[model samples]
Target: MTITARDIQLKQFKVKFRGFDVQEVDFFLDQLAEGFTNLEIDNRRMAESLKNAKIEIEELKAREEKLKRAYQELKKNLVSLKDEAQSPSNQNTSRMIITEAQRESERILAEARTRVERLNDDIQDLMKQKEMIDDHIRKAIELGKAILKNNDCPTNYSEDNDLKVKHLRQIP
Candidate 1:
């Protein structure tokens, strides 16, 4: 169950003939409440960050897939153009076919150039995203480490989100 500040305030302790200092108990409780607050805030911040990272990662993946599809289409078009060049049906009007093929080839070349440029742009974007994600992850790890080191706070996370983030990092 989620504990609230009221729960902490309402906690009771048994009174002894000469019990421990009440001020010490109160101080410890205050520190515990502050730790819980910090933990909740950090957890929320980390979750939002991870969500954004995953979104960017998905976008990069989609870009890569689109580039691959474009490349495949270009390859298929090139093969068709090559096959037409080798065919012998228009032997009498070979000049016309050559001229037409040359024009089509030029068009294909231009299209391929455009596709290559787009693919390069996608690659560059993905690279920049990778660097950003890495930087963000490193900073988060550093912050988590500092919190654990400085305050002995719990390091448990809500899910295996880090595994997915690491998987994205591994994608070249």
Candidate 2:
């Protein structure tokens, strides 16, 4: 069962003449519940942050794909323009048009290259962020395991959680 702070607070134990101190147990449970609640909040926040980062990455990838397609189209147009410029008819006009087109294509290509480089850098930064978050999560899990071990509780993590960690590590 997923125990909540309220459940911990409301938990009851049978008392005997020689039983452990009730107040001390209650105080410890309260502290544990508070810590658990904080951990839950942090986990939720991290998940949301991860989700946002994934969305941003997807959008950036889509933009990169569009830019690549545009670059290819520009290349094809440049080739066509060059072929037309080679013809004898309207040689002077063709030269001028070819020069203008070349300049424009070069400018566009340069801008596209710059944008792709920037996007690559952004992706690297995001990957670093993801690594840091993953590290934090691993640390949290280790801490939880330690806590459970100290309490003589089972520390075996769920297979689903392991699969998720593996999946995150697999992300490129």
Candidate 3:
């Protein structure tokens, strides 16, 4: 049966010959009750403390898991970085690509320069031919005007007859 301090304090005993004194028994019961009350209070405080400690442990475990995940992620990143730093072929490949691009640009520039030079030579030849043709036409017109001035009457020297006779060839 559950007994409280009040139950211990109010306990009674039967009276008999050669029995224990009431004051001594009552005094002992009071001391025992007081000690039990203090022990119960101490036990309650300890239980509360234990419960709080368990909660703190769970929180610490969760934090530890989070830290572990973060550490693993960081480790993966570090490994990739190390691989990049250790590999020389990737850098060489980039340099090779740049060299190829430079060579391609140089080849295109050379082809364009050659084409421009050929076009300039063709234009010079065309201009020379045009000047020669203009000189021939001017000479032909001047010679015809001189022939008309020297004739006494309007001669019947038609263009078709003159060309058939090659009259221009007869002139200088």
Clashing pairs in 1: none
State in Å the error of residue 17, model 1: 2.2
lDDT of 3 by residue, 74-118 (tens): 556555655665568676655555456556555655655555455
Cα-based lDDT for every prediction:
0.53, 0.60, 0.54
In model 1, which runs have C-alpha deviations exceeding 4 angstroms?
Answer: 4-6, 83-172
Q: After superposition, how far is residue 80 of candidate 3 from its true place, in Å?
A: 2.2
Candidate 1: worst-modelled 10 consecutive residues by lDDT: 150-159
* Model 1 C-alpha lDDT per residue in residues 1-172, reported as the tens digit of each score: 5564445556666655444345645654566556555555655565565566566656656665665666566557656665665657644455565557557656655665666566556656655655664454454444433332323322332134574355335433
Query: What TM-score does structure 3 among the candidates reach?
Result: 0.46
How many steric clashes does model 3 contain? 0
By summed lDDT, the worst window of 10 consecutive residues in model 2 runs over 150-159
* Cα RMSD for candidates in order: 14.1, 10.8, 63.0
Best by TM-score: 2
Rank ordering of all candidates by TM-score, starting from the highest: 2, 3, 1
Output the number of the lDDT-best candidate.
Answer: 2
